[model samples]
Each structure stands twice: as structure tokens, then as C-alpha cells.
Target: MLRRWREEDKEPFAVLNADPVVMEHFPATLSREESDALAERVEVAFDERGFGLWAVEADGEFIGFTGLSVPRFTAHFTPCVEIGWRLARSAWGRGYATEAARASLEDGFGRVGLTEVVSFTAVPNVRSQAVMRRLGMTHDPAEDFDHPVLSQGHSLRRHVLYRIRRRK
Candidate 1:
């Protein structure tokens, strides 16, 4: 089940970030302080917006997080909302990311009334790309960008954008 993040979730989330395999696509593993701060921000967003990165659980285990976030970083396409997800190494290949992310998209387009949603990943992150495709998102290569927050030459700088519009 998916639910809002809680303070108690920080430890498990930190563990998720600590996994080398899970952090491989990311630039670096998040420090415990960073993970706690992130969880606090997610909780605040949920309080203000009614939705944010949700704690994904199955039979009372913390799988990871999945939800919608307003992209704050500058991009070729700025000021867009995005649906995203991340899972622990143990959760990889289990369809949990896809399942939880689909629910996030549904809530974004259906409940939150967003007309469209976008997602992006580093150019080499095929796992995320596959999940985006499974969610019916279409690539817009023209919108691909070098992530502004990363150094210009960073290995994870280039990203591919994917988008999906809600059906009328």
C-alpha cells in the first residue's frame, strides 16, 4: 500500500539510499542527514498538497518511495510536475516501482487534476526508461537536457525527457 511519508520512515529510506546498487544511477548515495531532510520535505509537501513521495509498503515492509513532485531544477522544460519513483535493491525487478509509479500518475492526473505529467532520467538509466515506457509515457527527444544542477560534464548530466498527457 502507498501512504504519506512519516518521520519514522527515514531510517528505511536511508538504507535504501545506502544501497550501492540502488544509488548507482544517482550521482551519489544520500547521507543520512540528506535522507532525513528529504523525508521531511516530502512530508511537508504532502501536508500542503495532499500528495507527494509515498512510502510503498507490501505486507508491512518498506519497499521504497513513489510519487509526484514539482520539478524545481531548471531544465529545457522548466516548471513541470513529474512522477517518479525509486526502490531498494531488493525491490528491483519486482514490478513494485512500476506499480507504485502508476498509482502516482493516476493520482496526479485523476485526483490532482494535472493535465500532463513528465519524467526524466539520466541518459544511461534504462531501468527508469523501461518503467516510463510501461506507464505509457512517450519520449520527447527534443526536450532532452543536461541537468542544470549537475556540473556540465558530469556523467549523469544528460537526461531524456518523457511525457504523458491525461486522456480527456
Candidate 2:
């Protein structure tokens, strides 16, 4: 289930974020404090936007998060809603990312009334790109961009973009 974060979720969420495998596509694993800060930000986004990356649970325990967010950094696709997810290694291969992401897109196009939603990942993150495709997002290589948040020479700076439009 993708639900709002609770105080008790801090530790589990931090454990998910601290996993090196889970953080591999990005720069680095988040420290405990950093993970907590991220949870706070996620909650604030929900308060401000009506929806954000919600905590995920399985077997009635925190696993990770999956939902919609507005990219803070500028790109050619600035001002777009994006669907994303991250699950603990143990929770992977269980269809959690795809299931939760499908729900996120439903909320994006339905409740949020967004015309379109986007998703992206580093060049090597075929796993996430696969999820984006599974969510019906199409990629146009021309739309790809160097992530603004990454350092100029960073290997992961070049990222691919995928977008899906709300069905008529």
C-alpha cells in the first residue's frame, strides 16, 4: 500500500534509502538524517500539492515510496509532474514499483488533472526506464537532458526522459 508517512516509518524508510543497491542509480546512499529529511520533504509536498511520494508498505511494514513529484531542477521539460518509485531490495521483483506507479499515474491524470506525466533516470538505469515504459510513458531521445542537479562532468548527469499523456 502507498500511504502517507507516519512517525514510525522513519527508520524503515531510512533503511531503504541507505541501501547501496537501491541508491546505485543515483549519486549515493542517504544517511539516516538525510533520509528523514527527505521524508519530511515528501510530506510537505503532499500538503502543498495534494499528492506526493507516499510511503509504501507490504505485510503491514514500511518498504519504501512511490508517487508523483514536481522536479525541482530545470530541464527542457520543466514544470511537469513525474511519477517515480524506490523499494527496498527485499521488496523488489514483487511488481511493487509497477503496481504503485500505475496508481500514481492514475492519480496524476485523474485527481491531479495533469495533462501529462514524465519519468526519467540515468542512462544505465534500464530497470527504471522499463518501469516508465510499463507505465505507458514514451521516450524521445531528443527530449533527454543532462540533469541540472548533477555536477558538469558527472557520469549520471546525462539522463533520459519519458512522458505519457492522459488518455482522452
Task: Name every residue pair that clashes in candidate 1.
Answer: none
Q: Write candidate 1's Cα lDDT for 1-168 as tens digits.
A: 898776677899999988878888789999999988888888888888877888999778888899998887876676888888988787889899899999999899888999989999999999999999999999978889988889878999999999999998
Q: Name the regions of candidate 1 deviating beyond 4 angstroms.
A: none
| Tens-place lDDT digits, model 2, residues 17-39 | 88889999999999999999999
Deviation of model 1 at 138, angstroms: 0.2
Look at candidate 1 and tell me the lDDT of residue 74.
76
Return the top candidate by TM-score. 2
- Models 1 onward score TM values of 0.96, 0.97
Candidate 1 RMSD to the real structure: 1.0
Best by lDDT: 2
- Give stretches of model 2 more than 4 Å off: none
